[model samples]
Target: MTSTQEEKAEIILNLINKRKTVPKGVIYHDYNDADGSIKMQELQFLISLLEERGLIILKGASRDPILTITEEGLNFPGFEKQREIDAIAERKKEEREKLEIKNLKGSVFQVKYWWVILLLNSIISFLIAYLTKS
Candidate 1:
């Protein structure tokens, strides 16, 4: 299975965590054919994001970068915790959307029911008047 962006990031993070310091070439070479290894562009993107988040630092030139996890990153929760946090956030977002949909459906149903009631009342009144006159 293709690893997700998050999963790929976690994999890279774990590698850095274990080695403390890893050269750029080693990282690329190690994942050259591995299942979870990301593409070059994707790896760069992940590295940028991680650097921005203070999770990892890249030292040296663009072509020959060395990766080292930050102190905060080293102390960060395990990969499972990262996945759990992501899952919880996604679940909460879905739940909020579901609630909004339910409320919208309830409002629509109420309006439709009100219109039906009004039509029924009008018809009943008309029938009673006609019968009384006859």
Candidate 2:
């Protein structure tokens, strides 16, 4: 699923929080993939957004760029709480799907065995009736 810009911002905050000093190259490496990379323009857009919002600041030399989060960024939109909630919901959804698959398999197995038992019973009854009649 494509993540929203809000989610991307949250991810940026998380990276900043963890590393304390993040470089531009690291963000590009982490966010991009075979599916697609976040456009350089997009990353620059977000950086500008954060800077405008006073959440982060560009630091270090221009040649050796880094980012430093402000106090506001540390507590950006209560991200830690939301991240935890999202994680919990994802785990629960996975567990629920696993349980549903397990139940479906169990039901299929039971139906298969039930038909076998039913066929055997019918055959046994027919054999018993024929023998008695004879």
Candidate 3:
């Protein structure tokens, strides 16, 4: 990793490691302090760094849309906050899936349009030939 990336990872690790408990949202568990795993915008970047460095693992959370860390991920050197990092990883994956689904829908619509055009052309040609011959 580059020096800049390593530095950012350190920042994220420190913030998450300090958490005594986990609550909800992207803020601190205490709910008073602003300190947390990352600044709102940096959450995605932090997750990428964690995965790229093999600092965290992801497991499925009880909730359908959430993910938790698996048993295999106990602790990783350099990155101390496993859960926070895993959360980041899961969030990024969700975002990627959403975009892929959107693209798939668009592709399906394009294919459908092409098929409809072909069908219409064949029908028109058939009708014209039959009428002209008659």
TM-score of each: 0.53, 0.49, 0.30
Lowest lDDT sum, 10 consecutive residues, model 3, at 62-71
Q: Candidate 3 residues 1-134, lDDT tens each?
A: 55655666565544444542222232222222543334534555654555455544333442211212222322554433555788899999999999999999999998879978899999999999999999
* lDDT for each candidate structure: 0.81, 0.78, 0.53
- Candidate 1's residue-wise lDDT over 1-134, tens digit each? 13576677777787778788898677766666565455788888877877887999999888979999999888878556877999999999999999999999999998879979899999999999999999
Q: Once superposed on the true structure, which residue ranges of model 1 sit more than 4 Å away at CA?
A: 1-3, 33-37, 78-134
Question: Clashing pairs in model 3?
Answer: none
Put down candidate 2 lDDT per residue, 1-134, tens digits, no spaces: 13566667667667777888889778767667422468877777777777787899898876546988899788676545667888999999999999999999999999879979899999999999999999
Model 1 local distance difference test score: 0.81
Better candidate number, 1 or 2, judged by TM-score: 1
lDDT of 2 at 11: 73
Model 2 pairs whose backbones collide = none
Model 2 / residue 55 / CA error / Å: 0.6
Instruction: Give the Å error, residue 41, model 3.
Output: 4.2
lDDT measured at residue 116 in model 1 versus the true structure, 0 to 100: 91
Q: Report the number of the highest-lDDT candidate.
A: 1
Residue pairs whose backbone atoms clash in candidate 1:
none
